[model samples]
Target: MRRTLDEFNDRRWIDKDGYQYVATRLGEAIASGIEDLIERVETERKLRSVWQWLPDAISAFPFETWSDLTITVAEPDAPYRPVGRFESLLRETTTVRFLRPEVALMDLCFDLLYQLIAEGVEMRLIDRPECHRYFLSTYPNRSSEMIRQDHFTILEHDNLPSYGTGLLDDCVTISCYERDSGTVHALIDTDAPAVREWAESLYETHRADARRVELQKSAESVPHD
Candidate 1:
């Protein structure tokens, strides 16, 4: 304890008066800075596993919004936590827009998705060609049915980030996937307007560059025996 106090004194962070040491202004400032740094580090550690799968645009989000961000991570006992969160979002939304790189997130939600479409929810999706192909093969009847709906639209982008983005009603979500397995590992969502605006701009940029998919054309592109 003596050596630690001496080190603090040497750094001018503390002053000794008649054997009683008190923290100086510099000490308080340093302590506050260290507290913030530790908090940021902890947040990073929590996101480390899925960090690489998050959208690069997330870095531009205001730092203050990080605390307000809601993170739902999948757990061993509840492996479908993130998916359940997404489904709940789906059930309540009147509008849905997404940039999807993989189909895993939506694969299990096909029934709900189709029901939403039938209920006249406006939905637009920008996804990779391979993802569309896979979905068509996996759910031929439902895929065909949904695409024919006026309320649903599909656009194909050859390249997309590993992570997925969604603008569901007023909420914005970033879905992080496992690196090798391609299953959703976590979801980071926020209702912050600034974050939602950023997501909207990103979605528009990708949508503008993507090509609309024609149902017959897409189905024909898939190989058959």
Candidate 2:
């Protein structure tokens, strides 16, 4: 400890104040820079696993909002943690708009979504063709029933991000998945205005390019068991 202080003192990073030592202005500035670097590193650490899956727009987000995000990472012991968090958010929202590459909705979420739809909660979904086919095949009856409702809407977009973006009520969430396994690895949620704005913009852009999924056509496109 004494040797470290001597080194710092030699560099004028610390100065003697009677019997006590105080940091110099240069030392304070260096400390602040170090603190900022640590914060950036920590933020990167938290986002690294899911970073590749995130949309390009997220890269431009303000650094301050990164800390405000609620990142729910799937654990080895409980691999469904991210999905559970999203389901909880789904239950509370009256409106949902999402760009989905895959069907991350579990059985319970489908039931809750059904109830929400019957209660007139609005939902607009943009999904890839294969994912839409999978959903239709997996939940034939429910998909048919829900697609017929006025509150539910679907669009098919061939070029969607590997990750999913969901705008549930006022909150925005980015669901990252493992590419090979197709499992939800993390769910990043936030109410930051910048993120919400970006999400809404992206949703609208994709919605414009996507083809609407007609109830009759979609049903015929997929074979049932």
Candidate 3:
């Protein structure tokens, strides 16, 4: 300890300010460092919860106790697209509020529709206008024709956020934007009451102003080419 102090002094690390720093609140500083270390360890453990390093991998609320849920994403794409396990969550769920930007029509048209419809679950799709012509050029077969407003509404994308949000009944999922790789979307799924309420409020507030989609009117009947 004496040698270490001598070395610190020699390196000018133990200056007058440094001495003051240790004298003033040395115990508190030590405690804070330990706390930070513990937090890092806990964070590392949570990150390893899932095989994939998603942003929202931890959930405070026990999944077994929750009922129906909701999900939201800042941009158009949903992280759930790559998550096949997400389908299991939808099986028993009745109503799901999918608040997001324009999604790939193929992703929602058949598989999602079939799962939700088969379960007789109410799946609300809230997004801006998706260019049907754009889908036609890249992908064939217009599956978006299957989206019926009878089950839900299509709200115009308004006040989009930078981060992704998901409200799963009691739990919530959040992710930050990664400009480098879209696949490496970080997730932070939690069941904190405050988070759930906040997410729900954001959805309800804009939902009032969202444009209600009339499926028949939104699309023009075109002969199969």
Candidate 4:
């Protein structure tokens, strides 16, 4: 059975021992995937392109819990387009390890990258009679006020979709952070063709942003001698 955030938190899911175990396993998986992508990029002599390395990086980690994983890269500063979708499968079962600084950093970077690419995605804590989990913003930011108004005015609501409903109605983004573990997974779902196209366009934008950052750094590094 799937565990809710409250149940997991009540059970001290983020305890040191549990956090360590999850982080270590997740880190190793991500590192391996990145390394493989790096090798392939080098062979193809496309080392300068981050997008070229993404596929291998994603393929490196097997997604066991998340049924769908989609990425969209947009223009620098623009919201991401839906790149593609993925289904995760776990290869093995193992015990937890301690969370090292490196592992934590890796997890943070992954989340940051996802947030940057997928702008306006909010994380909300949800509660149901049977389960609770952090639900990602499936709808655009504009709908937030309407949701808030509806929340206070209504006593009982039935139209809202549950987390991981696997429906294609609203574009959903699920950020998964293992309880009692350090692993973090972000899943995005959107059946909209326009959204997907936007995600792909974001890749070019990301490259541009990277170049701008480098330029700024170079400008700052110049000194009067």
lDDT of 2 by residue, 1-225 (tens): 899999999988999999989999988987899999999888888888777777777866778888668888988998888878988898889999989836664443778777889889999988877776777888887788788898899899988878888999869999888888878889999999989988889889999999988666767666665
Q: Estimated TM-score per prediction?
A: 0.76, 0.78, 0.53, 0.18
Write candidate 3's Cα lDDT for 1-225 as tens digits: 878666655655554463452322554565588887786566555444332433232244334312222332233565554233344444545666755523332243446655555556666655545533333333333434345435644455556554445444445555444544533233455456756776787778767777765544434453344
Candidate 2 clashing pairs? none
The 0-to-1 C-alpha lDDT of every candidate, in the order given, reads 0.84, 0.83, 0.48, 0.29
List runs of model 2 lying over 4 Å from the truth: 1-41, 106-108, 217-225
- TM-score winner among the candidates? 2
Candidate 1 on 1-225: residue-level lDDT in tens?
989988999999999889598889999899999999998887777667666666766665656676567789999999999988989888989999999836878887888988999999999999988888788887777787788888899999887777889999869989989878988899888898888888888899898899998876666555543
Pairs that collide, model 1: none
Q: Across residues 1-225, which tens digit of lDDT does each residue of candidate 4 receive? A: 235544544554432364342324545565588887776555334213222223332334333211233432233444222111212210111111111112222222333323322443232211221111111122223223223431111111122222111222244332223235423222344344444344344333332332111122322333422
Off by over 4 Å in 3: 1-40, 44-82, 101-110, 131-146, 175-184, 220-225
Backbone N/Cα/C clashes per model:
0, 0, 7, 25
Pairwise lDDT winner, candidates 1 and 4? 1
Q: TM-score for candidate 3, please give it.
A: 0.53
Q: In candidate 3, where is summed lDDT lowest over 10 consecutive residues?
A: 65-74
